[model samples]
Target chain A: MPEYASILFSEVLKILMLLVPVLVSVAMIVWLDRRVWAFVQKRRGPNVVGPFGLLQSLADALKYIFKEIIIPASSNKVIFILAPIITMTLALISWAVIPFSEDFVLADINVGILYLFAVSSLGVYGIIMGGWASNSKYPFLGAIRSAAQMVSYEVSIGIIIINVLLCVGSLNLSDIVKAQENVWYIIPLFPMFVIFFISALAETNRPPFDLPEAEAELVAGYQTEYSGMMYAMFWLGEYANILLMCALGSILFLGGWLSPINIFPFNVIPSPIWLILKILLLFILFALVKAIVPRYRYDQLMRLGWKVFLPLSLTWVVLTAGYLMYFDLLPGN
Target chain B: MIAHAVVFYIFSFIAIVSAIMVTTSRNTVHSVFFLILDFISISCLFIMIGAEFLGMIMLIVYVGAVAVLFLFVVMMLNVAQQKNEWFVASDSSSHIPIGLLVSLVIFSELLIVVGGWKYKAELQDSININLNLNLTNTQSLGNVIYTDYVHLFQLSGMVLLVAMIGAIVLTFRKRSGLKTQSYLRQISRERNEGVELIDVETKKGVKIDA
Candidate 1:
């Protein structure tokens, strides 16, 4: 009993250790996204807060906390309130299986990648529920768009992940990272990597595929009625999901915690730092994509997912399986 | 073992309650939400019983994709306002007793099966594909599915492919009279075709059309 208690206590401690930094990083990511956007648009972004606007996100949090949460009179109150909580919780929970380095993950379960996939796929629920519960036409439309969009992109993402799994042989995230000790999967699976990245963008409802929350037309999309902390929760959850996608991309393709090169100088740096660097680099690319690309039309987005990415990734999966089988390099063979 | 039993009971209870709510909820959207809850709790039960892969797959396929599709249809059709009057509506009053009788019969059949299984527990041992405790759930599933049940697996994949193609064919339409940008025409334009230079007289405009 004592041993069990100690294990439970240590697990809680580890979760705190992982979560605290992640929450802080989510805040910083929000600030960084704005600053990056401002730089691209040739404007000074949030210079009044702490040095270089480092504390801008904190100020925004405080502002949101003090603001009144206005619930719509005709809305379904329970589901309206539950939506943001679900979004925030689901966004944070996927981190349970993400390994920063060896022995760093909270839950080293066998189906870690599937757990992430499952949790991320369920993210549409929050948006759909919020939109539906709002009792408005725009939010309902937004929810419908989100449902179709997420479903379409997830098919291609599943196929791409299958391509990776064929090479790795295990669903475990750590095992995937370990398999890339000598060479990253990105070198061999470059096209799938690109598809996965773009799909990740679409999956997270980022710019260019953020049709769900297209502010210009849908008037903030599913979040049309959300206000105050509830709205802030949605914001935080969005950034967290973006960060999660970046981490997932790095892990699946960029070799997780592995160094770029296997040389002495490259290998000396710590693994977790390498993972962090890769995640940041990916995040920068995410932000830059947001800055450069125009928002996709709904039909075009659907076409890209179903017509282009779906067939391309499906073919890649077949090619990958054939290559592995031909060379007798399939794992666990 | 105590904790395992406790979690099992909790998940099963939630699953049962959500399953009931799924059928009983008046709001169609609420029913879909309850259905999602039911799937999630059942997946939790599966996970507790050492089927993590199946549990996560349940979440990914059913709660994630299927339920979202349900919500999409519910919202689009504006069916949330429909009052769920299963047996109470005036026009539907005649089928109430028959429906109840049918449900009772099914319930009793399930009860009989469970009671029989409890009495003859040894009969359950005759299963062809036994769970191998040595391998992870996914690994064992892969082994059996790829080798022993390969044809069935391939057949299911073909079924899904046919369904997908059928859905696209049913919904796809080629609408005429809509103006769409032709990339070839846009890209193939030359400077000579687009531009015309002419010397005009002092006050008269050139007849460009001619």
Candidate 2:
């Protein structure tokens, strides 16, 4: 029994280790987004808090912690509270299967991809419930729009994932990254790569696809009623998801943690540097799009998801299958 | 062993209570929230069963999509007021006959199915697949769907496509007096002519037109 206890304890510790970096990275991303936005507009962002705004996220955390939570008079109190927790928890839960380094994963289940996709899909509930429980029209409208957006884009996302699954033959994240060590899927599957990146942006509800929270329309969307720490939870969860998507894109297409700079003398810089660099590049791409593009209208966003991305991804899936079949390289064959 | 059993019992107890709350809650939104709790319990059960795929699907699909849809539609709907009749439908005289018939049918069906099932409870222990190392279920499911169930799958896709198109056609209406931007016309416009400058001076007594 003590032996079993020790095993469980180690597992818990492993999970906590993986979680710490992800949470910290999410905080860093918040700072990075603000800084990038400031730089684009030629203004200094968060310079007062700490050196180059390093401690800004910490100060914000403190602010959220100390602020009073306001529950609306007519709102369902229990659900209003539970909604943000659900969002935060679902967002964090996927970290269990995410491989931060080559062997540094909390859990390595066979269905890790499915697990990540599933948890991500489940995040909509938190938004919907937050909107419904607030008993506000704007939140309700935001919830409805977000739900439709999520479902529409999710199909394309699934197809893009299926494209990757075809090459790897396993749903494990570690295996997927390993399969790309020799040659990243991006070389052979560039079209699908583009589709996946765009679908991911939509899936995370980032700008210009962030119609759910369009201030001109929905007045802050599903999170209008959330304040203090609960509001912070949603914000953290959104950043965490962005980090997760960047990591996933790196793992799938960019050869995660594999050295793109292959000069022999500096090859010893550790694999995680390559991984971090790749993820950072993708993150910058996301921020660049936000800075450059205008917010899309709701109907236009839906058209892009369903009409453009879905068909493109589905075509890529069929093409991948055909290529694999021609080479007789498919699993089980 | 006792501690594990105790924890399981506690989780199961909470699950049952939450499920009861889901059905009985007066507030529709509250019911949906309880449903989410019920799904979390089922996910826990899936973790126990080593069927993480199905468990996560329950979370992603039922709790995430369907339940959210339910809550969204329910919250938006305005319910009519009516007198409370909580106990009127619960009288034994009104329920016993229907309850007996349901139990009898369910029991008989369970007996027949259980008797015919080839696999035994003991056999399942040795037949269990390792959750981490195995790669059989999802792959095989995909294989069969692509091969044997190809027609059915394609048919389902067509159905979904038709339904989606039908929805788009139904909801898409061209409003009167709404000017829409034309892609071709916009693209073909000469840049120099697209914008024209008009000069005018505005002053209370010295306004002039050019």
Candidate 3:
């Protein structure tokens, strides 16, 4: 191969290494989501597919593949098809910056967090496109609702991340993680972590903030008009985003790849395993919140994101900066 | 390198095409999507030029928030169905010459600036940014924004704050005969007020209103 072709081949291989696991894990995560929801409701969830229903997600994907794809006659066909592709693509690509372990990232860019933020922000287009292209009232309403909800919560998310940034004084995700070697941010920035988790829920359009797709009101929101593999793509993208948020939570607060007790036995484990475990822990909390918490009304959700979270996170940013400066511990000073 | 030039041309082509399509697209939603595409392409160019922070920020701020809001309004209203009126003949078409003249002047001015820049390349450093090539793009930009140009940065922030407040004040409505919940009053209500201990009579019924 030529030099450029060889470089391209290796890059593609690297991307596959990162993405394949993420997509596979999305399957298990969905199964886990169902199991948790079932456990909360005292029911057996998908035990028929495999032991503990491990292969259920695979079966679902197969079913989606075999099913007929129906395009609504009134819909805009180009955008209708483009939306889900964009969703899944963006969701998967954001993983390029996420460090699984020290020196394990695909793209160790300097502006890693900003790159993630940028990709996640573009995520709204998928939902909005699917909604508006449907040419239906329900999807349109859902799209409009999510656009407002996302933009509102993104402000607070940015502020909360700034608190973490101030401590580390770097935008690199790994640097942020390394800064937590002494103590995880969860101890000191507990409130900001709580707000970030909640905002993550809202950002992913999960429960307690899933006004965009409220079944009672909007009939599955933006996903209503989608069917077959299109619907499955949305489901995959959503779970992937949820997992990304979980990873982010672990990296920012729970100390990515850092064991709780740094001893001989604990230190023996590889770094990636610890990162996965932390992500799983955060993901379980997400599933539990989904199972237990009732969805919020739209107005209440807006009030929480704007009125409460905005002011609180902003104040926390100032406080963290002040505390860091007062001790003459500001990074790079 | 050849690769750099190729990538630059690709992104610039996409940006130019999308910029043109933003006005030409019949559907308002499509126009907004085109605008997003234009932003994305330009940001790609920024990133290719090694300004990763600016590129990402452009994506987040312009393509993400501003364009999403544009799509929101275009979708929510019936504006998506509105036909494109570009180049359409109107009753009074007097502004065409003035528009052409203004654009011509601007184009020539751009030409002059570019042509003169080849001879006087040093003019680019008039701002004295003191950019340290050792620092990463984010760090260098931060150093400049937070230290030397701090007051200007803060003033711009103040402008944005004032604009936000102005928007809110204009949109804020005080209406009479509307029921709104006062959360403090609702939360502070006594249990005695909420519940009545009186027993109800069998058929006569208690006057609950009283």
Candidate 4:
């Protein structure tokens, strides 16, 4: 093949490789959660679907594609339709910046962390618009709750990230991962790790912090009026965000692609494989928490965020900065 | 480079148009939403400027908090169209002339400044912005405040503290409906006394309970 053609072919192959894994992995996460929930509740979940419900997500996607979409008479038709699209699109776009391993990122921007934050922040608008456009009280309340939840959790998240940045001394995701060759920052910044994990749970609006979709109270929250493909998009976007958060947690705290064992025998798994294992483990941990923990009341949730997590993360930032300064690692120290 | 330029222009165009619509729109709620769109696009503009920190902060602070607050207040106000007419009508008549004049003045000033100066783009580019540029626009603005601008920062903190105290003093008032708890009152309460068991016996062996 000619050089240009070869380059183009390689690029296409790279895209295919990245995209296939992400899609399959996301589907697997959904399946795993279902299976885990079934085991926890002492019941079989979707065993009838292809080989212990492995194909359940594929079936779900097909169902969504063929389903009838109903636009409410009272809704602002434009915004109502656009909301889920925006939500799903923003969620997918953030994945472009997330590095799976050393050479796996799509965009590989210098400021990957900042880019991710920016994209995730925009994700809130989808919920806000969905609720507002619905012209329904339940969805509106859910949207407002989501907005507040995101804002409160996002602050602590930022502070925790500051702690990480202090350790890594670089904004690039790859550099941060590489900095963990000797040791992961989690050893020193355990408090920040916990804080970041909790904040991620809240930021993604997962169970115990999912006031936006508190079915008992808000009638499915922001997606109360949504059905068919639009609803599915929101659902996928949410799970994608959950996966993203888990991936981020692994990368930041657990050492991105580093094998746990330093010995020769355990070095069988490649770096990317190690990364996948860590992310999967983290995802299971998240799902376990969701399965076990009861939902927090709105006031209690806000209090935890603002009073507990914020202060802890801020203190972590200060401590990390002090340590870095003492060791002559901080910028301009 | 061309791709980035195109993207910048596209977002800039949307931002400008949305901002114009925000001011022009009769529906206050819709206008508030347009303002949000404008903020998001401006954050994109910040990204184009290579100010990633500022862009992220703008999204987090402006889009995530301020815009939400605006939406909340706008939704709660429940002002009808008739009430809106007063503000909207007055705004339109007064705004057009003032806006035009202001834009004209700004454009003319920009033209004069650029025209009067001999362009030294290279010299300006060579200047280390990381050293000279004030990072106030960054999310790490707090860091710079404590380190470089410590004295000014301390003064600002003191001012804010005083303001907070003054606000508290101003707002402090005794009201019947207001609920306040004293730590002494709280601590003094015995848990055993807070709960009690009561028993009552009624007529015969019919076992009527009270």
The numbered model that scores best in TM-score is 3
Which 10 residues in a row give candidate 3 chain B its minimum summed lDDT? B79-88
The order by descending DockQ is: 3, 1, 2, 4
Cα lDDT tens digits for candidate 4, A1-333: 387588779888877777677767787789888888777778797677799889999898889989999999999898899999998888777777767777877777667887787778778889988998999999999998998899888888888887888787667788788888888978988888888888999999998899999999998999999999999999888888888888888888998888786789657767888888888888888888878899998988998999888888887778777877888877533
TM-score of chain A of 3: 0.98
Q: Candidate 3 on A116-184: residue-level lDDT in tens?
A: 888889999999999989989999889889988999998999999899999998999999988999999
lDDT of candidate 1 over A169-280, digit per residue (tens): 9999999999998789999999999999999999999999999999999999999999999999998998999999999999999999989988899989989899999999
Which candidate wins on DockQ? 3
What stretches of model 2 exceed 4 Å from their correct place? A261-263, B1-18, B80-135, B140-210
Better of 1 and 2 by DockQ: 1
> B1-210 in candidate 3: lDDT tens per residue?
998898899999999999999978867778889999999999999999888999999999998899987886776665533433433468226668888899999999999988998788667674686566778988888878999999999999999999999999999999999877778999999999899888878898888787
Q: Estimate, for each residue in B128-147, the C-alpha lDDT of model 1 and write its tens digit.
A: 65656778889988898999
- TM-score, chain A, candidate 2: 0.96
Structure candidate 4, residue pairs in collision: none
| CA displacement after TM-score superposition, residue B193 of candidate 4 (Å) | 3.1
- Please state what fraction of the native interface contacts candidate 4 reproduces: 0.54
* Model 4 chain A weakest lDDT span, ten residues long: A324-333
Query: What's model 4's lDDT at A132?
Result: 89
